[model samples]
Target: MKLRQVVPWGFTAIVAVLIGNGVLSQLTARGLTNTVNEVMQGYRVQTSLQALEQVIVDLQLGERGFIITRDPDFLRPYQTAQSNLAQEFARAKTLLQNEPAQLQNLNELEALSNEAIAVLSNNIARVRNGETPSSEELIQGNQVIEQVRVKVAQMLQAESQTLATRKDIVTRAEILSAISTLGGTLLGTLLGLSIVGFVIRQVVQPINQVTLAITSSSTEIAATVAQQEHFATEQATSVHQTNSIMEELGASSRQSAEQAQKTATGAQEVSQLAETGIQAVSYTLEDMSVLKAKVEQIAQQILHLSQQTDRIGNISELVTALANQTNMLALNAAVEAVRAGDSGRGFAIIAEEIRKLADQSKNSAAKIGVLVSDIQKAIAATAIATQEGTQTVENSLKTAEGMAQTFTGVTTAISSVALNNQQISLNAQQQAIAIQQVVSAMNSLNEGAAQTANGISQTKISTQKLNEAALDLQAVV
Candidate 1:
C-alpha cells in the first residue's frame, strides 16, 4: 500500500477506538442515574407508611382525651386525624404500587385501619351523648390502634430494606462507571499512540529513503551532463575549423576543373594540325612518283638514239669501199686507149674523164667515213650521260619515298599524342568533380556536429535543474 492510504487508515482506527470509549462511558453514566432515581422512590414509600401510622395514633389519642374529660378541643384532634387517615392510606398504596408484595400488605393495612377508625368513632359518639364509653370499648380501641402501629412498622421496615438494596446498587453502578471510563480512556490512548507509531514506520521513513535516493541519482546525472557539455563545446570548435578547411578545398577543386577544360581545348587544336600534316605528306609522295616515271621514259629514248648512230656508221663504211672500186676501174680503161693510137683518140678522151670522176667519188667517201666515226663517238658519250642521269633520278625517287614514309609515321605519332592529351583532360575534370563532392559532404558533417553540440548543452541545463529539485524533496522528506 501507498503512504497516503496506510496513514489514513491508521488514524481512522485510532479515532474509532476513542469514539467507542466515549459511547461506553455514556452508557455507564445512564445506568448510575437510573439506580439513584429508584433509591429515591424507596424513601418516598417508607415516608408514606410512617405518615399513615401517625394518623392512626393521633386519632386514638384524641379519642382518649375526649373520653376522660369530655373536652370539645379534644374532638378537634380526633376530627383532624379522621380526615387525614384515608388520604394517608391512599398515599401509602400509591407509593408502594411498583412492589407487588408491598401493595398486598398495604391493602391489609387499609382494612385494619378502617376497623380502628370505626372503634374510635364509637367512643367519640358516646362522649358527645353525655354518657361515657365502657372500659372494654376503650381497651378495644387501644388494641386496634396498636395493630395499626405494627402494620405501619412492618411496611416501614419493608420500605427501608428496599431502599438499602437500591443504595447498594447505586454504589456499585457508580464504581463500575468510574472503572470503565478509566479503562477505556487508557486503552484508547495506548491504541492511538500505537497507530501514530505505525504510520511513521510504514510511510514517513520510506519517504525519507526515497528522497535521498533521488537526490543522489540526480546529482550523478548532473555531473555526467556537465562532462558531456564540455565535449560538445570542443566538438563545435572542431566543426568550425573543419568547415574553413573544406571551403579552401572547394576553391582548389574549382581551379583544377578550369585547368582541365583548357587542356582539352588545346588537344583538339593539335589533333587538327596533325591531320593537315598527313594530307600534305601524302600529296608530296604522289607528285614524286609521277616525276620518276617521266625520267625513266627519257632514259629509254636516249638508248634508242644511240643504236641508230651505230647503223649509220656501218652504212658509211660500205659506201667508202664502193667508191674505191669505181676509181680503180676508171684508171684501167685509160691505159687501154693509149695502146690503140690514132684510131681510138675520141675513146681515150672519154676514159680520161671517167678517171677524174672516180677520183672525186673516192675523196667524198673518205670524208663521209671520218664524219661517221665522229658521230659514233658522240653517240657513245650521250649514252653514258643518259645512264648516269637515269641512276640519279632513281636514287632521288627512293629518298623521296623514304621521306614520305617518315612523314606518315610522324603524323600517326602526333595524332596519338593528341588523343592521349584529350583523355588526360577528361580524367582531370572527373577528379575535380569528385573533390567538390567531398567538400560538400564535409560541410554537411560540420553542420550536424554543431547541432549535436547544442543539444548536449540543453541536456546539461536540464540535469542541473533536476538535481536541485531532488535535493529540495530530500530535505522536505
Candidate 2:
C-alpha cells in the first residue's frame, strides 16, 4: 500500500483500538460501579436490620427506664423508636428486594420486631397507668425481645453474606477491569508499533530506496552531462580554432589564386612574346636571306666589273702603242714638209697638230691604263668583300633559323606554362572556395558545439538540483 493509505489506516486502527479500550474501560467502570452499588445496597440492608433491632431494644429500655425511674425522656426514646420501627423494616425490605432469601429473613425479622414492640408497648402502658407489671408479663416481653434479637442477627448475617458476596464481585470486577485495561493498552501499543514497523518496511523504506536510486541516477546523469558539456566546450574551442585556421587557409588560397592568376597572365604574355620573337626571328631570317642574295649578286657584279676593267686595261695598252706609232709617223711627215718649203709649211702644221693629238692620245691611254689597274684592284677588293659578305649572310641566316627554332620552342613551352599557370590559378580558386566552405561548416560546428555546451551546462545544473532534491527527500524520509 501507499504511505498515505497506510498512515491513515494505521491512524484509524489506533483510533479503533483507543475507542475499544475506552469502551472496555467504561464498561469495566460501569460494572465496578454496579457491583459497588450492590455492596452498598447490602450494607444498607444490614444497617436497616440493625436499626430494627435497635428500635426493639430501645422500646425495652424505655419501658424498663419508665418502670425503674419514671423519667419522661425514656418514654420519648420509646415513642420515637416505636414510630420509626415500621419505616426501618420497610427500608430493609426495599434494600433487600432483589434477594428473596434476604427478604424472607427481613419479613421474619419484622414479625419478631413487631411482636417485641407490642410486648414493650404493653409493659409501657402498664407503667404509665401506675400499675406494676407482673414478672410473667416482663418475662414474655423479654422472650419476644430475645426472639427479635435472634431474627435481627439472622438478617444481619444474611446481609453480611450478601455484602461479602458483592464485595467479592466488586473486587473481581476491579481486577478484571485492571487486567483488561493493561492488556488492551499493551495490545494497542504492540499493534501500533507493528503498524509503524510495517509502514516503515513497506512504505518508507521503499520510498527511501526509490529516492536513493533517483538521486544516484540524477547525480550520474549530471556528471555525464557535465562531461558532455566539457567535451562540447572543448569541441567548440577546437572547432573555433579549426575555423580560424580554415579562414587563414582560405585567405592564403585566395592569395595563391591571385598569384597564380598573375603567373598565368605572365606566362601568356611570355608565350605571346615568344611567338612575336619567333615571328620576328622568322622575318629577320627572311631579311637575312634576301640580304645574302643581294650581297651575292653584288659580289658577282663586282667580279664582272673587275673582268671589264681588265679588258679596258688591255685596250688602253693597245691604244698607247698606237698613239706612240702615230706620233713617230707624224714627226717624220713634218720633216719632209719642211724640206718642201712654204707649201710644205701648212702640211707641217697639220702634221704637228696630228702629232699633238697623237701625244694627247698617248697620255690619255697611260692615264686610262692606271685607272684600269686601280679599278681592277678595287674590283678584287669588292669580290673578296662580297665573298665574306655571302659567308656572313649565310651565318646570319643560320643564326636566324636557329633563333626562329628557339622561339618556336620557347613559344610552345610558354604556352604550356601559361596553360599550367591558368590551371593552377583555377585550382587555387577552387581550393579557396573549398576552404571557405570548410570554414563555414566549421563555424556551424562551432556554434553547434557552443549550444551543446550550454545545454550540457544547463543539464548539469538541473542534475545538481535533482540531486539536491533527492537529498532533501532523503532527509524528509
Candidate 3:
C-alpha cells in the first residue's frame, strides 16, 4: 500500500525465514545427536559381546587342555576368563540397560555362559580329584558353549540391525538439515534483492515522477477545473457500467444458488440409493450364508442316505442267500415225495411250487440289490454336487460382503458430496447478497463523483490565491 511499510515487512520476512531454519536445524541436530548416541552405544555393546565370546572360547580351550593333559598350569587361562567374562557381561548389560529387549537377550546370554562354565568347572574338578570326566559331561559342556557363541552372534546381529536403522535416520536428518540451511539462505538472499528492487521501483523511480507532476501542475486553474468535470462525467459512466455488471453478477449468483441446491438434492438422492444398495447387498450376503448352511446340511443328508443304501444292499444280499437255501431244500423234498408213489404225488407238486416260489423270491432280492447299488451311486453324485453348491454359496457370500463394503464407501462419498453441495449453495447465496451490496455501493460512488465535481469547481476558485504560492514552490524545487 505504501513504500514506508516495505522495509519492516521485508526484513521481517527474512528474519522469519532465518528463525524457521534455525528451529528446524536445532530439531534435526537434536535428533541426530540422539541417533549418534544410540549408534555409539550399540558399538560399545557389540564390542563387549565380542570380547565376551572370546573369553568363552579361551575358557573352553583351557578346560580341554586341563582335561587331556591333567596339567593344572592350563587352569590359569580358565581362571582369567572366568573373571573377565563376568565383567564383560556386566558392561554389555549396562550399556543396554535402556533397551529392554537387548537387556533380555544379554541376560539369556549370561545365563547360558554361566551354565557352560559350571560344567567346565565340574570337568576340571574331576581331573583334580584323580577321576576322569564322563564323555557325556564333556559333550554337554561343548554343546552349551556352542549355544553361548550362537547367542552372542544373535545379539551382535540385533545390534547391527539397530545401528543400520539409526544410520539411515542420521542420513535423512543430515539431508534435511542441509536442505533447510540452503533453502533459507536462498530465500533470504532473494528477499533482500527483491526489497532493494522494490525500493528502486516504488520509492526511487516515483521521486522523479512526483517532481514532474509538481512541475506539470503549474497549469492555469480553469483547465484543471474542466479536467475535474470531465473525470466526474466519465466516473458516472463507469459507475453505470459497473452497476449493470453487478446486476448481471447478482442474477448469476442467484442462478448458481439454485443450481447448487439442485445438485445437493441429487447428491442426497444418490446417497440414499447407495444406502439402499448396501442394505440389499447385506441381505444377499445373509441369504447366501443361510444357503451355504442349507447346502452343507443337504450334503450331509446325501452322505447319510448313501450309508443307508449300503445297509439296505447288505440286507438284500442276505435275503437272496436265504432264498437260495430254501430252494435247495424244496428240491430235496420233491425227490423224496416222488419215491412215495401216488400218495406222495401231491407232496411232489407242492415241493415243485415251493421251489419255483423260492427262485422267484431270490430273483426279486437280486433286483432289489441292484436297485440299491444304483441308488447309492446317485446319492454319492448328489453329495459331491451338494459340496460344490456349498462352496459356490460360500464364495458368493464373500462377494456379497465385498459389494456391501463398496456400497458403504459409496454412501460415505455421496454424503460428502451432498454436504459440499449444500455448502456451495450457501456460499452462492452469500455472494448474491454481496453483489447486491456492491451494486448499491456503485450507485453511491456515482453520487460521490458528482459531489467531487462540485468540490473541484470550488477548488478552482481557491487556487487563484495559491498562484503566488505555486511560483514560490517552483523556485524552491
Order of candidate numbers by lDDT, starting with the best: 3, 2, 1
Per-residue alpha-carbon lDDT of candidate 1 for residues 1-477, written as tens digits (9 for 90 to 100): 543344345434534543444454445445544554575466567657766765676677667766765767766767897899888878877777788999998998899989998998888888888888889998998898888778878887787687667656755654654565455445544644564465456534644564454345335444543453343334443443455553454344344335434433443454454345445545644654654465455446545654654565576567567756766775676677677775444445545545554564555445445544644454344344434434443543454355445435534533443353344334434433333333224445456445434533443443344334333322322
> How well does candidate 3 score on lDDT at residue 50?
73
lDDT of the candidates, in the order given = 0.55, 0.60, 0.63
Q: Write the per-residue lDDT of candidate 2 for residues 29-145, one digit (tens) a residue.
A: 456445545654654565566667667766776677676666666577678888988788778777778889878877787777777777877887888788888999999999988
Mark the regions of model 1 whose C-alpha exceeds 4 Å error after superposition. 1-6, 237-477
Q: Could you tell me which residue pairs clash in candidate 1? A: none
Name model 2 segments beyond 4 Å from true. Answer: 1-5, 67-76, 97-100, 124-133, 203-212, 219-477
What digit string (tens of lDDT, one per residue) describes model 3 on residues 1-477?
A: 443366447655755664565456446545754664576576667767777887887788778867876777778878999989888887887898899998999899889999999999999998999999999999999999999989988988898798778767866766666666567656765775676577566534543453353334323333443444344344443444566665665565566557656656765665675576566657655654654565455556556656766786787789789889989999999889889876555556557756765775686577567655644554454444445444444554554466567557646654664565566557556655554444234555456445544544443333333333223322221
Best by lDDT: 3
Q: Estimated TM-score per prediction? A: 0.50, 0.46, 0.46
